[model samples]
Target: MTAPRVDYDRIRDVGPDRAASEWLLRCGARVRYCGQQKWTQDYNNLPTGPLDRYKIQAIDATDSCIMSLGLAHMEGLEHVEKITLSKCHYIEDSCLKRLSQLEKLQKSLLEMEIIACGNVTDTGILALQHFRNLRYLFLSDLPGIKDKENLAHLLKVALPSLELKLNLK
Candidate 1:
């Protein structure tokens, strides 16, 4: 199947955080709002209060259908601190590139995990260098990564204080 299409008009109507939350949920991912304790997983039962009340702080896209094109929903998100991309078959190098280019995410994102995404290669992981404020990165089960040592070293050089863990084959 093709990747999910982004709705720019929805983003304009509901604001970035809510729009992104809807997109992520529709793609079978879970999202945590800035002050909410529970993860919102059900698209039909999305939290309702204020249009701008819920700010997306974390995303768990494990085994979801999230793709590179859908990452555009994150453009205006300013409070996203953590993201987990595990076993997302549609995720690829372009997804990482798109994520790294998000100026707001680059400053707010502190932790990320990429696991079991077969399409992600060293080129994609390397794109994370733009997240200068990222403090922790976990990578595992990504067989496409060929130069693990060099990629780790480069990331270390780019983000001196980052904590990186790799369990690649």
Candidate 2:
């Protein structure tokens, strides 16, 4: 059970078993949800403050459901530096549209990992182009993306320093 308003630092001090979503609000934390629960809806309730860096290693993100709280919640984060979403089976390319609104993350994002997404194809991978500040990217096991030529076309311009690792299997 996650509390709507949590005390992150207090939870951190107590360790992850005692962590809460509120901590993500406190100090720009990094979170990876790989267990049985899905944190997708929680993105909607995040406070209107700049986030630190967050990583969601939802590999095997087995929640076979659509969890969208609307893209309105991403408006407040001005300080988010990185976000990683790997192996989340449910998140598709359309979900990347939500990230376009995060204008502040234009030139400083670190990594974006999208692996084995059932709904994400070339069109979906191309959606990642908006993150102009992205440096490191991992796109393994996606069904549609082909070689670097196609990958280069997806991220045509913007994050010139971008590096991508992909897979077609």
TM-scores for every predicted model? 0.96, 0.56
Q: Report lDDT (CA) for all predictions.
A: 0.94, 0.51
Question: Over the stretch 52-153, how does candidate 1's per-residue lDDT look in tens digits?
Answer: 888999999998998887888999999999999999999999999999999999999999999999999999999999999999999999999999999999
Where is the poorest 10-residue window by lDDT in model 1? 2-11
**Candidate number of the best TM-score:** 1
RMSD of each: 1.3, 9.5
Q: What is candidate 2's lDDT per residue for 45-141, written digit by digit as tens?
A: 5433323333333222233332223223333334445455555554776776666546755443567776666677777667677777777777777
**Model 1 TM:** 0.96
Q: For model 2, how many clashes?
A: 4
Q: Which regions of candidate 2 fall more than 4 Å away from where they truly are?
A: 1-66, 146-148, 156-158
